[model samples]
Target: MQDFTRRATFGLGAAALAGRAFAQTAPPGGIPRAETPPFAVTPEPGASLRIIRPARFVEPDETIFRANAQRFQDKFNVPVRVDFVGWEDIRPQTAVVANTGTGPDVVIGWSDDPHIYAEKVVELSDVAEYLGKRYGGWAFLAEKYGKRHNTETWIGIPIGGNMGPCVYRASAVKEAGFERIPEDHDGFLKLCLAMKKNNKPIGFALGNAVGDGNAFAQWLLWSHGAYLVDEEGKVAINSKETVEALQYLQALYPAFAAGTLSWLDPSNNRAFSAQEIFLTSNGVSLYFTLKNDPGTRAIAEDTQHALMPKGRATVAPQTSTVMNAMVFRHTRYPKAAKAFLAFMMESEQYEPWMQGSLGYWAHPLKAYAASTVWTADPKNTVFRDAMENRFWSGYRGPISQASGAVAADYVLVQMCAAVASGQATPEAAAREAERRAKRYYRNT
Candidate 1:
C-alpha cells in the first residue's frame, strides 16, 4: 500500500479526470470492458445467504442498498437476508459469528474487522480484483483495507467509507473572527476558542462513540505526530509526541460544549442540528438531515464542510468509518456470497447507490468520484477526497488483528477522553494508553 501522505497528493482533479475517462467508455448499466473475464462464479443449489451490516445513517443509504439486494435476488434467484444493527453493536456481533462458526454468511463490518477475524473469513481476491479491474481500481486506502498484511490475499472487499469531515456553521465561523476554518492547528484552536468566547461553542464526541469519538481522537493523536504503535506494530503510545497530543486535547477541550464528555455518535449530530453546537465532525448526513426537515432549513443552509486542520504532521490525518464486506468461511454458499458482493459493486448498482447516499458514503472505487453527489453540493466536495486523505485504523503500522483489538477496545478514545475530562494528566493518559494498547499488541 502507498503511504497515504504521498497518495494525498493524487488530488481530486486527477481522480475526476480518470472518472470522466472511464465514464466515457463504460457500457450503459454496467462496467467498461476489461481484459479479465467477468465474474463467472456459480451459486450453489438451495443457496440462501444471511448478511449483517451496520444500520444506515441516512435513509437513502438503506433504501438504495436494500433495493440493490432485491435486484441481485431478482437476477440470480438466490434468497438474500440482511440484518441491520447499531454501529456500536457490529463488532461484538461479528465476533460472535467468528467464534461460533455458525452465523451470518456475510458481514459488512467496520475498519480492520476482517483482519481481526481473518482466519475465519474466506478470501475474496477474485471478487475484489475483478471489481478493481472493472472500476478503474480501488483507492489507495481501499486496497490497504482490502488486502491482508504482507500479502496479496484479500480478506474482504471495501464497500465505502462514512467520512466525517469538519462540519460547521459558516456565520458562526465568521463571527468568531475567521472567514473560514483554518488549515493549521494553532489557527483552528484559536477559532474554536473564539467561537466559545462568542457563545457559539464547538463539540466533538468524546465518549464511547464508535465513529465520531474515534475519528476525533485519532485525528488529534495523528495530527500531533503520534500513534498507538510504530510501523513494526509495537506499542509506542508513551512518547513525548503522545503526551503533546494529549496536552493539545486538553487545550481544545474547554472550547467544547458542556457534556461533551458523555457525547455519543448521535449526540454531536443532534446538538449541531438543534443549534446547541456551532461546529462538529460528522458525515454529510448531518447536513442532509437538517436540509430535509423544513424546520431546520436555515441551519442547513448555514452549514459548511472542511477537512480537518493539520498539526505537526502537516498532512491530512483524519480517520473514517470504513465499511468492508467479508464472507464467512462457514457459509454453505461461498460462490453465491462472492457473486452477490460482485453484483452490488458493479456500476449499475453502485453508481445510483453512491449518488443516493447523498455523499454520506465516500466511494472506495476511484471511478465513482464522478458521481454527481459530490458536484451537486459544493459542501460535499471535501469528502470526495476522504479516502485519499484518511489513514487506516492502525496508522504507521500494518493493520492486523491487534489493530482491530485496539480499535475495538477504544484505547485512543479513552485516552483523549481521560485527558480532556481531567481524569488524568496528559503524561498519565499517554502512559495508561500505552499499557492498555500493549495488552492487544503484545503478541504482534
Candidate 2:
C-alpha cells in the first residue's frame, strides 16, 4: 500500500490545478474531439444491463442521471435499467449482488466498497485511465478510491462525491454572538455552546445512517488526530488521541438537540426544516429543500455552508460519500457495462448532471472545479473543493476489505454514541472501539 502521508502531498498539488479549466469542444452527444481516445470495446450480441445505486437527494440529480442513462441506451441500442435505493441500503444490496452473482451487472456504491469486493469486480483500468487523461486527471481521493490497494489496477470508476458540509443558519449563528462559523476547534465549541444556551441547538446523526452518521463520527475521530488504524494498518483506536476525541464529543454533545443519539440521515434535515434546530451538518440538499419550497424561502436565504472545523490534525478531517461505479465479474455484458460507464462520465453528460445536482455531488475530476455550478451561487462554493479536502474512509492506512467492514459495522458511530449518551466513559468507549476494529483488521 502506498503511504497516505505522501498521497496527501500529491493531492494538494492536484488541488492547486483545479482552477485551470480545460477548453475542449465536443459535438452534440459526442466525446470531446481534441481529447477523445478511441473506446474500442464491443457489446455482446444480447447486451443488457442493470445497475443499483443510492437514491438522489436532489430531484434534478435523479432526472439528469436517468436522462444520461437513457442517452447511453439510445446510442448503443442496448437495454438498461437502474435501481435507486436508500443510502443506508446501498451497501447491503451491493453485498447481495456480490454474493449471489445474479443481480445487477453494475453497482455504484460508497467509499471502500470496491476494495471490499475487489476480486469480484472486473478491472476498469482502461475506462478509468482514459477518463482521467481526457479530463484533467482524477483528483487524489478519487484515484485512491478507484484503484486496488497496492497496485495501479482499477476496480471502479469514481463518479463523484456527496459532500457533507456544516450547513447552518447564518441568522441563528449571528444571533448567537458569532459573525460567522468558527474555523478552529475552540472557537467552534464556544459557538455551539452559545447556540445551545440561546435555544438554537446544533444536531448531528449518531444512529446508523450510512452517510451523515459515519461522516460525523469519522470527522470527530480524525479531527482529534485519532484513527482506527495507523499507516502500517495496525489497530490504533485505543490511544490517548481517541480518548481525547471522545472527551471532546462529551463536551460538545450537551450543545446538541435532544434525541440526537437516535438521529438518522434525514433527522437533522427534518429538524432544521421545522425550525427545531438552528445548526447541523448536512448536504446541500437540506438548503435546496428549503429553497424549492415557497414556505421555507426565508430559511433557505439564511442558510450557509462551511467545511468542518479543523482540529489538532494537520489537514481538515472532513469525510464525504464517495460514489464509485464497478462492474461485477458475473456480468454477461462486461464491455457494455464499461462502455456505459464511460459514456456517463463524458463531459457532455457529466457536467450537466453535476450542474443539476446544485453542489450536492462534487466533481471527482480536477477539470470540474471550474464548472459554473460552483460559481452559480455563492453558497455552493464550499463544495467545490470537497474532493480535494476529503480524507478517504481509512485515513492513514490502505483501503482494504477490513476498512470497508469496519465502516459498514459502524464501530466509530457506536463508540461516539456510547460516550455521548453516557452509556460508557471515554476510556471505555475507546477501548471497545479498539477491540471491535481489531476484530476486522486482524487478518488483513
Candidate 3:
C-alpha cells in the first residue's frame, strides 16, 4: 500500500494554446487539494503499464491526462507508457489490439466499448465499487454503458463523457423572427425553414462522423420516438417513428449547407465557426473556440445553447461521446493499472484535471456536477445537462457488441445520408437501416 499527495501545480500551456481559439471555459476559482491516505497494489517486478488513448485536441486535456500519468509513473517508479491514437482510429485500433491480446495494459475508450470488447477486457467491478463509494454512485448512463447486459459485472470504469447541445447564433435566430429558440419539433422545423429562407440555414452533418454524425442521427430518430432496436435488443429500425424521422430529415435536407455529406467530426465545427451555417449539433468545443478568438467573440456572445428539440418523445439529447478507462485481461500489471485509474479519479486530481478542459468534459459522478465550472457559466450548465439526458445509438435496447458494430459500421449515418441525398426514399432508407442492423445483430 502507498499514499499519494496531490501536485499543487499543473501546466496549462496546452490549454492556453487550444483555448486561444475558444474562450477559456474553466472556472476562474481554484480547488483545494486533498490527500489520498493509502492503497495497496502488487506491482509487476519488471513490467510497465502501457496506456493507449485518443489524443485530445484540447491543450488543457492533453496536459492534464498526460502530466498526471507522468507524475504517477515517477512517484511510484512504475514506468507508464502512453500512446495516443487518433479519434477516427481508436475504436478499430482497440478492436485489433484486443483481438490480438497484445497492446496497452490500460485504455481510454469512447462509445459502447465496454460491451464491444467485454470478453477481451478485465472486469472492473472493484474499481467501480471503490469510486462509487468514494464519490457517490456512478451516473446512470455511465453505469449503463459499462455493465454487461443482464449482469452486475462492470466491463470498464466510467470516467467522463461529452455532451452534444445545439450550439446556435442567438442573434441570427432572433433575426429570423424567433424570440427564443424553439423547443418542439414543429417550431424547430419552422425556424429552420425560416433560416433557410433567409439564406442562413442550420447545419447538421449527413456524413460519417463517428461522434457528431452518430449523435445527429440518433438524436433525430430518438426525438421522433424511433429506435434502431427494441427494448429486447431486437432489430426495429423500420417503424412509423423511424419513417417520420427520415421524412423529417428528407424535408430538412435541402436546408442544410452543401458538403454536409462529406463531413467528419471537424466539419460542423469548422462550418459553424466560419459562419457558413447558423446552427449545428456539437460539443462545447466550437462555442468555446468562438469565444476565445477576437474575430469570432461576437458570435460567441450571441451564441445560445439548447437541448435537441423534442419530437413525439422526451425533450432530451442522446449524447454519444462517452469516455471510459478499461483494464485489459492480458495485462501483466492489473494491480498497477487499477492503481493508476484510482489515482486519476481521486477528487483532488479529477476536479482540477477536468477543470483544465474548461467544461469540455462532463462528470461521470453526480457529485462533481456541483463544481463551479458548471455553475459559473449558464452555457456550461446547459451543456452539462446533455450528459444527464444521454442515450447512445442503441437506445431502448441493450448496448451489445452488435450495437457497437452498427456504430462502427456507420450504418445509421449512411442511412440518413442516403435519404438526405435523394438516393433513397424515407421508407427505403429505413428498411436499409433495419436490414443492416439485423445483419450486425445476427452476426454478433
Evaluated against the true structure, the overall lDDT of model 2 is 0.82
Candidates in order, TM-scores: namely 0.92, 0.91, 0.90
RMSD of each: 7.9, 8.4, 6.2
Candidate 1, superposed: residue stretches over 4 Å from native? 1-36
- lDDT winner between candidates 1 and 3: 1
What is the lDDT ranking, best to worst? 1, 2, 3
Residue 396 CA displacement from its true place in model 2, Å: 1.0
lDDT digits (tens) for residues 108-150 of candidate 1: 9997999999999999999988888877788878888889989
Candidate 3 ranges beyond 4 A from true positions: 1-39
Q: Write the per-residue lDDT of candidate 3 for residues 20-133, one digit (tens) a residue.
A: 332223332443323333555646666588787766645456566666666566567788766666666778778877889988888888768768888888887877777776
Clashing pairs in 2: none
lDDT of 2 by residue, 1-444 (tens): 101010011111222223112111222222233366567676777899988777777666665677677767768888878777777788888899899988999999988899999989999999988888877888878888989988999998888887788889898899889988787778999999999999899999999877889989988988888888878898888999999999999999989999888977878888999888988888888887888888898989989988888888776688778888999999999999999998888777787777766767888878888787788798989888877765778777889989999999999999999999999999999999988998889853
